[model samples]
Each structure stands twice: as C-alpha cells, then as structure tokens.
Target: MWWFTQGSCFLPFFLVVWSSTSFILSYLIALFRRDVDVLFPYISDAAANPPESCIFGLMTFVSACAGMATIYSRFKFVEKLSEETRVVNPQLNKTTLVLGILSCIGMCVVATFQETAVTAVHDVGALLFFVSGVLYILLQTVISYQAFPHESSITVCRVRLAVTVIASLAFFPTVICAFFVKQTDLHRVKDSKDYPFHVASAVCEWVVAFSFVCFFLTYIDDFKRFTLRVMTELG
Candidate 1:
C-alpha cells in the first residue's frame, strides 16, 4: 500500500530483490540437491534439475513479468521527461521499449524452456535476453546523457554508463568462453579440459546477470520522482 502511494520507484526495487532472490534460492536448492557442483554454475545449470527446476521456472517467470513492468514504467517516465524538457526523441524511446520488451520475452522463454530439456531454444533465449538487455541499458544510458541537466544528472548518467560498460565487457567473455567450453556433463564442468573456459563463462554470466539487476536499482531514485496512473472516461 505504501509502495502504491509513494511512487513507481518500488517497481525497480522489487525487481532487483525478487530477481536476485530467485537466482540465489535456485542456486542453493541445486547445491543442496547435489544437482550441480559447488563451483560456479551457469544460471541454467543451477535450475536444470527436478525440484530446483520447478522453483526456478516459477520464480523466473514472475521476475520476468516484474522486469517488463519496470522497463515499461521507465520508458513512460523518460517519455514524459523528454516532453517536458523539450528534448524529444520518440524514436529512441520506442526503440528502447521494443528492446526491453524483447529482452523480457527472452527471459520468459528461458524460464519456460529449460536448458537441459531444450538446449537450442534455451541458448537462443539466453542470447536474446543478454544481448537485448545489454543494448537496452546502453540505449538508456545514452538517453540519460541526452537528458542531462534537464531531466537527469551527470552522475546518474555516468553510473549507468559504467554499469553498461561492465556488462558489455562481461558479455563478450560469457559468449566466448561458453563457446569454447567442451564438456560432456553440463552439471559438472570441473573435470573437463576446458574447465577454465567453463568457469570463466559461468562467472561472467553471473556478473552480467547481476549487473542487469544493478542497472534496475539505478532506476529507483529517478522513479521516486514520478507516479503512474490509469484514467478512465465514461462514454
């Protein structure tokens, strides 16, 4: 109730907490079940088993929904700010929204189709989610810079830029290492000759995932300044 009255800021905060909890809980469950090795695991590896898979799927679905809502709210907020500041960029705003939507859809796809079950589809979903999500944040950072002094602060813009850059840096290694990792067992990659590559990829995947979470955390402060409303007209 307080969150409803205060502002849409809570959306991003909720997204961060919920998404982080989903991954952590899933990881712990997988570890407890011995479904995955104690070492670094690809996010999908942690959720590929029976019990953890079920929980991970449900939790990730909810997180994806929250992510979509947060992205849409940010899009609308930026659109309003741009109008007020006379720094119109409707095309960019729309493009960001499309990217955000596609990324969220990818998240849903990943949640619905487990990597162990549907490997190809799952990998595609992951690629879609990671690439589109990174591009979305990068575009948002650009927009933040564009709105500087008028609708946003230089500090916030810089922070976003840093997060985007880190995610981007992590993204490349994630893809590259995973490509090189040759392992028969998905759950236990430590025995493989390419174990180092697997470790690098898994670690980088976690970094990119958490970086996406942190990016949403940056939205909390800006979202606090605005509220969303739905209006109805009687015809």
Candidate 2:
C-alpha cells in the first residue's frame, strides 16, 4: 500500500511529463516529415507556425517558468534569514523548506496568466497538467529530503544510494520516448518530426526532474519520522 501510494503519484506525473514531451516533439517532427519540407524558397505558413509555436511556447514557457519559480522563490530564504554567512540552522532550514513548498503553489498564479500571450491563449489547459508535473517532482523531492540533513550518514551514504537508484530507474520512460522522437531531416517533416538534438536535450530535463523527486521525498520522510519521534518522546 505504501509503495502503491508512492507509485500512484509517481506514475501519473511521469506520464503527464512524458506526454507533453512527446506531444511537442511529435508536432516538431511533423514540421519536417516530408522529403523536401524545408526548401530554401519555403514560405512560412501562419496556420502551421503560430499554433505549433504557441503550443511549444506556452508549454515550455509554463514548464520552465514553473521550474524556475520553484528554485527562485525558495531562495527568498536569504531575505528572511537576513544573514550573509550562509549558516545552516535546522530550524531556519525547516522554514526554508516550508516556504519552498509555498513557492510551488505560487506557480499557479503565474500559470493562470500564461494565456496573456498568444501561444498560451488556447492552450491554458496544458499549463494545468504542466504545473502538476512540475509540482509532483518538486514535492516528491521535498518529501524525500526533509527527513535527514546532509550531515547524516544515512542520507549522504547508504540512503542516498537507494534514492539514486530509484531516480535512475525513473529515466527509462522519458528516454524511451526521446529515442523514437529524434530525426536528422528537419525539412522533410518541417511540420512534424522532432529535431535529432532535441530528443537528447529533453532527456536531460527528465533527469533533473527525477533527481528532484528523489531529494524531495527524502526531506518529507525525514521530517515525518522526526515528528513522530518527538510525539512519542513527549508522550
């Protein structure tokens, strides 16, 4: 049941991220499917260009933006800490993690306004899915890492290995999709086939996401254990 709870959230979000990556890539691939699609005299078509560009721009913008906001908003710890030394205090660090989660929530506001741009106008639905995908991994990492601090042998040594293995396992799904999505001929599928390089680049994104999930999970588990132990001691 525990594993089920873990996998339920993990698999769904994995599919969500995979679908976005695949959908965008397939669109790009169609852009280059034909034998001479990218000819020099090629006239740019608004119908083909705008919608797809909007699709990508909206999704990627929302995606990367949400990811940035996760990292950036949490950084406000510097402001709240009001100290230049970068000292790590457990209490303050815990507050930082809490604020980080809030930042993830704040991404919703930014996502809602994506439609202010042309590309994102009709595709706002995609942003919702993108936000979930982004948050799942972030929250998953927070769950994983909040437990034990970096100084612990369990976290830095043994437990870290287990989490790394879990992360490495998560990449196969995205990597598999990225593999079939790549093609060298862009002109042929000018409106279809994804770029050969893009397939590889997308894999890098999945890796970061998987690692973030692993770390976040650690944080949550550690904190939960700490809380329970504290309760028992008090009782």
lDDT on C-alpha atoms for all candidate structures: 0.89, 0.39
> lDDT by residue for model 1 over 84-112, one digit each (tens)?
88675989999999999999999989998
In model 2, how large is the Cα lDDT of residue 220? 28
- Compute the lDDT of residue 174 as modeled in candidate 1: 98
In the order shown, the candidates' Cα RMSDs to the true structure are 1.7, 12.2
Q: Which ten residues in a row have the lowest lDDT in candidate 1?
A: 183-192
Candidate 2 has an lDDT of 0.39
Instruction: Report the error of model 2 at residue 17, Å.
Output: 14
Candidate 2 regions exceeding 4 Å error are: 1-95, 102-194, 228-235
TM-score of each: 0.95, 0.32
- What is the Cα-based lDDT of residue 181 in candidate 1? 78
Give residue 28's error in model 1 in angstroms.
0.5
Scored by lDDT, model 1 comes in at 0.89
Model 1: how far residue 131 lies from native, Å: 0.5
